[model samples]
Target: MKVLVMKPQELHKLELLLPQDKIAKVIKKLGRQISEDYEDKDPILIGVLKGCVVFMADLVRSISVPIEMEFISASSYANGRTPEEKVDMSGGPEISIKGRHVLIVEGVVDSGRTVQTIIGQLRQKEPASIEIVTLLDKSKCRLVDIDIKYRGFDVGDDFVIGYGLDEAQKYRNLPFIGKVANE
Candidate 1:
């Protein structure tokens, strides 16, 4: 089968979904809220890798309270838009999560499979508390229930890219979030 590759410039045709300023505002609000909620707990900000890097970086900076940060890599989109039943995870938290307040940060939540799986695994580690914060929430596509403590935007079910989210590992460097054309 021939692989179809999208040129970087072709992304210009995508519709702008979330601008940088808007994303920043959301992150700032989330950061402040997290800081206030965890003022005494000293939470560990765990980023879901590959996609959460950009959002996590900005969010951590916006947060005023001191906190620890770590990354866990996982993916369920090996084939297409719909996530696979299984999640492939690696490089989980290095420190002990037992009794620690863990916060999972994600770029977007669509099917909720990947994040849900991660949360279940983290629960096994016996953290004091676990919560989720996502930059974008696509509730229309959710196949499972997830409690998102903080959400930046509620978007329709569309293939989005930018600000850390990607398409075939491309378009992640875009400064703003946008929906793929015809998807």
Candidate 2:
């Protein structure tokens, strides 16, 4: 399948939600908390690909603890704005997670289904523990119960983009988080 690339002006108007400086401050705090909690225990951070790229990169840098990084592909939004009935989950961490602490890093947690699915898959690997860390949490849109150990911010039901979040696989390069105004 071919992808359509449009000029920036053609995209929907965006309203700034989280500025870069603020996001950075919050991430630093989260990193400190995680570092303290997982002290001495080396943890593996598994990032959900496509969306989590930017956030995960920044978050990992802020973390003071020694952590192994990995990437996995898990998405409920294949193309459209609303989530599809079935979440597409693939890819696995190359490193062994057996008897090790695992932290799943996510850019956004909306329906909670994708995270749940990932946790279930990782459980099979016999990890000693598993936790979640998300940059944005859309708790109101959750269809299933999920515990987010670390959360940067909570947002309403606005279609958000930028800072690794995208619409039609676009706007991931935007430095700050924004809501599509006309969406």
Candidate 3:
């Protein structure tokens, strides 16, 4: 069997599906909303690393209000020993959330297991509130029900990549999200 690379048609299809400028515009609006909502409150932004670094950076720069940032890495997927499994916490940061508002920045919320674990663990720290902000939400893939406070995009199930998302660890630098084009 011969495997073909991406074609212009597939690229055009993806462009029609998701506009690059639109995505940026939505993110900027989300940032403004967060700033307005937390104008008087100082929230600790906990970025879920590896997956969310792209979204986190954009989100941090978008917010008008000052916010502190920390990282929390998790991977419940058992090292992909079983692709069907969910993500696990590789490890958490040393940031203190006690009595402080916490916002989790995430790239994708597929199974909801990663966020669930983070929330559960942070809840024990005595934080006043904990919320989530995800760039992409795939409702079809959610194994657990987790409420998201802010969302940039709610998209259908497709092996998406680019704009900080990678496939086989490549093409994350693409300006827009796209799938491996079938020829």
Q: lDDT values of the candidates?
A: 0.88, 0.90, 0.74
Badly placed stretches (over 4 Å) of model 1 are 1-12
Please give the lDDT score at residue 182 for candidate 1. 74
Q: What is the TM-score of each candidate against the true structure?
A: 0.92, 0.94, 0.83
Error of 3 at 156 (Å): 1.3
> For model 2, what is the C-alpha lDDT against the true structure?
0.90
Q: Give per-residue lDDT, candidate 1, residue 49.
A: 86
Ranking the candidates on lDDT from highest down gives: 2, 1, 3
Best by lDDT: 2
Q: Quantify how close model 2 is to the true structure by its C-alpha RMSD in Å.
A: 4.4
Please write out the lDDT profile of model 1 over residues 25-121, one tens digit for every residue: 9899999999999998989999998999999999999888889999999888883666777888998999999999999999999889999999999
Worst 10 residues of 1 by lDDT: 1-10
Tens digits of per-residue lDDT for model 3 on 1-183? 222335444432233335579878888988998999889789989988676777788888999998999898875544331224555565665777798889998877777888898999899899888889988887787888899999988876665666776554555666666644432
**Between which residue pairs do clashes occur in model 3?**
74-89, 74-90, 75-88, 76-87, 76-88
Cα-based lDDT at residue 103, candidate 2: 98
lDDT of 2 by residue, 75-99 (tens): 9997888876588988889989999
Per-model C-alpha RMSD: 4.3, 4.4, 4.7
